[model samples]
Target: MASPRELTTPATLTEESVRRYREDGFVHVPRLLSPEEVSVYRAAAESILERDMEVWAGGDDGAAVEVNYTTQVWRKDETLRRLALHPALTGIAGRLAGVPLRLYSSEVLVKEPEGAPPTLLHDDEAGLPMDGLEQTLTAWIALVDVPVERGCLSYIPGSHLRADSERLRHMTSFEQFREPDEVWPDFPWRPRVTVPLRAGDVAFHHCRTLHWAGGNETDARRVGHGVIYMDAGTTYLPGVMDEYLAHMEPGQPLDDAELFPIVTS
Candidate 1:
């Protein structure tokens, strides 16, 4: 088990654990940080909720929402910035990506109590418009205790290695990600697995993994941080990309230090 203060320090990832990521496309790393250490991160999250955050909102303006998924929280405060650049994540990303990784973005995905809407099955890569779509993933760390009842994620094992990945790659929208297993009847995947984690436990997942979280059935809120990691030197794809890319140059590579600095090299 990791001590509270050792939260920022990198853990020695075992070969077997790395192999799990290679094969399954997702692995839950235990004791990534202690609950005491996670308090600071929780504070950061609370601070974010306290203000008018420039959150993506996941289509909900405020009321009658599915989940209060917010983005760019790292841009607002110091604790969030530290969590985004934490060396522990980069160390793991270096091993997983087999190349230096950069911070793509940091977000808070919160599911409020009283049956918050479930997250429909979807992959992070298809939603992102990067040309090197496969060169990215999300490092998720639960900010609070997350059981299946509290909106934890469930992933279809080995779906990232599917043959019809291209078809699964660029979905027009999350609503459009109807069960791919049905579309490609031959899609190779085992039954989905629901991830359960306490505060500070982490899960690393490939960008293309078909995953979803159930509605929050518990009385408390479910919250976690997703720090985006992209392999260095990925570029923007113009026409097929999301609306956010309208500001950047069409052919520009996303290697900007100020925005997407190298987390590991």
Candidate 2:
């Protein structure tokens, strides 16, 4: 495995990079992780899938055959956690958010070859009902090389600054909210860029950026992981409109513990 130093570099996002992000609402950081690191993560993912295949296959009776999100893979899987909180990625997120960042959530989204549905199109903030324009950032890391034809990500640049419209619809996954005509009426709704990524490349997007991913038509699998980061001062809105500050545990603040445990006052 590559040393942590290779993966974690303390560099500021360039002016052009920041400008492009503000203009397009997203930026792609190519080769963020070494091939060795990528391989480690890939092996970890496969191990997880193997252990959970019974559950994935809908274990025992027919009752277990339902498709559900699995948090266990992340909680127990060391490699996933390591990659999720990689310093280089979090440092960039911290810079973007303008506050100390915390791991909001970690998830692995795998689209199997053929027959899988596209993820709904919507902003990340749509899931959390909070007023004001405070932004949350998401780092999407590809575990395997992905081509445009094999379900790479598509985005509408600079759409994050726009107000949330009725065009935004609620769905179980991010891909369902896509209605290109409703979101972009002027131009022919073609993506300016199709992010074809090598393994370990990361794409960072603002919370409100408009993006979507299509179904995988290839015979191979398309797997990616997402790690969301929120600025330090950001409050977690539990239940309804009530805001609760995060309380951190000693050195564990930098690492994932629970949801913002320490609310710095």
Q: Which candidate wins on TM-score?
A: 1
Candidate 2 lDDT tens digits, 1-265 = 4344454343745667666876788888777788898889888876776665322442345431222233434456888888877777776666555555656666666767764555556567655433232557888888898777567787877777665553342343434445656665642544556678778888888877777777677787777777776655454332221232234332232333464322111
Task: Show the colliding residue pairs in model 1.
Answer: none
Report every candidate's CA lDDT.
0.77, 0.63
The 10 consecutive residues of candidate 2 with the worst lDDT sum are 237-246
Local distance difference test, candidate 2: 0.63
Clash count of each predicted structure: 0, 21
Q: Choose the strongest candidate by lDDT.
A: 1
The parts of candidate 1 lying over 4 Å away from their true place are: 1-11, 53-64, 164-166, 171-178, 187-189, 239-244
Q: How do the residues 12-130 of candidate 1 rate in per-residue lDDT, one tens digit apiece?
A: 67777788887888988877776776898988887787674443355556544566756777776788889888777778767876777888888888888877878877777767767
Name the regions of candidate 2 deviating beyond 4 angstroms: 1-8, 52-69, 72-74, 129-133, 164-192, 238-257, 261-265
